[model samples]
Target: MGERVLIALGGNAMTAADGSASPDDQRRAVEGAMRHVTALITAGHQVTLTHGNGPQVGNLLLKNQIAADVVPPVPLDWCGAQTQATIGALVLNALEGRAAVVVTRTLVDPGDPAFQDPVKPIGRYFTEEQAGHFEKLGQTWRRFDRGWRRVVASPEPLEILDAPAVEALVAAGFTVVAAGGGGVPVARDDAGRLVGVEAVIDKDLAAAMLARAVNATVLVIATDVPQAVVGFGTADARPIGSITAAELRVLQAAGHFAGGSMGPKVEAVLRFVEQGGDRAVITSLEDIGAAVNGAAGTVVHR
Candidate 1:
């Protein structure tokens, strides 16, 4: 039997330099993404996919806000769920019947601390003046070079609601795409009915949870970088090729990874490995094949 792998795709894998989210542009990105995934499939790996929707969800939120006067704006959680379905459909279409895209939902604890402090940034950038306007309206803001944008809480994922469906697809020899935008954060009501919450769940953390749920042996997180780096930008910056989970945790404790970027990736890896996953690799989408073969990227082990 071939090894089963769960691939967590980063936003850049589907994003373009021009930031255009047109279907054609996304198709092009998906084409590039499939090349890496296809290589693994051809090499006899049973693959399941998950992806980020930071940019897409942000755009959805902006559209909702703009159309609010005529139609009430949807909440962020619903917007995230919508992006997951939209992007998952795009991925399924791109696969040309080779894979199945499941509109997945993930369950989170209603009491998660993130709800108290929505800190994850989403949507389009704006000028300082424009940001100030939103800020005055009581929206949380984060400033970037282009301007500022509203950020929302990104809680950790507890369970992927569609895991059984994903596993069924994988067992039936189909590639699965689920947990987009961290599976659209949801929590169970007192009656045990799933209800959407107003938070984004970190996609990487959700991916790790999905991997565990599916009993995948390998977890590959495809990011923009070819390898995980230490001391990211300075002259002493170094690339991490391979490391044990314990060592990675030590480095994490020392703050070698930035919270907004590399930190989540590293944390995901450690979690997966600790959960008995064979290995987790962090590498660029283009280098996925090489990374799997140990020719490139950072590989974390138990």
Candidate 2:
């Protein structure tokens, strides 16, 4: 029997750091990533895919700013739409049989404290001068180790509105692609109608929610790093292979992960496993094939 798998693709899995964000470049990147997906499919595993739109959306944001004088700026929700369409189409092109990109909406607390102080960075890294320029336009920026970056609200996801569609797609033997930029952050009104928010959602958390909702057995988080590690970025840093979710939670509380990066991935995987997933993986873009085969990368289990 085939196991259901939900793959949360990190940006680096689809695009390279030195690569430009042209359509051709992105297509090439998607094709490469899909090779791993194809492998999983051949191995008789049902697959659903989600990806981070940090770079793609960042490029769109750049276009928004560059054309601000001539055209009204596009809303964050619309930018998410553009990325979902673009990336979804790219992946669906590589996938055989029927597939569809469901525009996902995730419910979040409208009063979430993240809105008061935005911390999620999207788009390209900017120099101090560029960051200052955006700040003057009433935008927010924070200095990262990679340099200054634009900050936006990243509220925790409460629910995935399109989860049923994802489940249906997989049931129909369709490769489902959804939840770009954390499912176009939205919240419900008093009457229960969804109201779109101007924010980006954490991709990993969103993917984990999708996994649990669809009852996927495996959740694969492919990132730039090889796997979760201890003392990251230091000479004494060490890779963590298979670990129980309980022990991983202890290590997380010990501060072995950084908030902006590995921390969220660890938290997301732990949630997946604790919620009854058989396995969760954290691995590099290049190792996705091996990671899924249990030959490489970090694995988290209950």
lDDT of 1: 0.84
Per residue, candidate 1 scores C-alpha lDDT tens digits across 1-302 of 56889999999877775767777787788777887788788889888999998878777778865775578667777787778778877787766757888888888888888878887777888788766766665578888677687887777788888899999988899999999878877898999998888787888999999999888998989998999888889999999988999999998998899998999999998999999999999999888887766577899997
Against the hidden reference, what TM-scores do the models get?
A: 0.92, 0.92
Q: After superposition, how far is residue 32 of candidate 2 from its true place, in Å?
A: 0.6
Candidate 2 TM-score versus the reference: 0.92
lDDT of 2 by residue, 1-302 (tens): 76888899988756756756777788888988888888888888888899988778888899987887788777788888788888998898988657778988888998899989998778788799988977887788999999998888989899998999888887898889989878988887889888788899989999999999988888999887888998888999999998899999999999999998898899999999998889999998777777776677899987
Q: Kindly report which residue stretches of model 1 are placed more than 4 angstroms away from their true locations once superposed.
A: 126-148
Clashing residue pairs, candidate 1? Answer: 58-123, 118-153
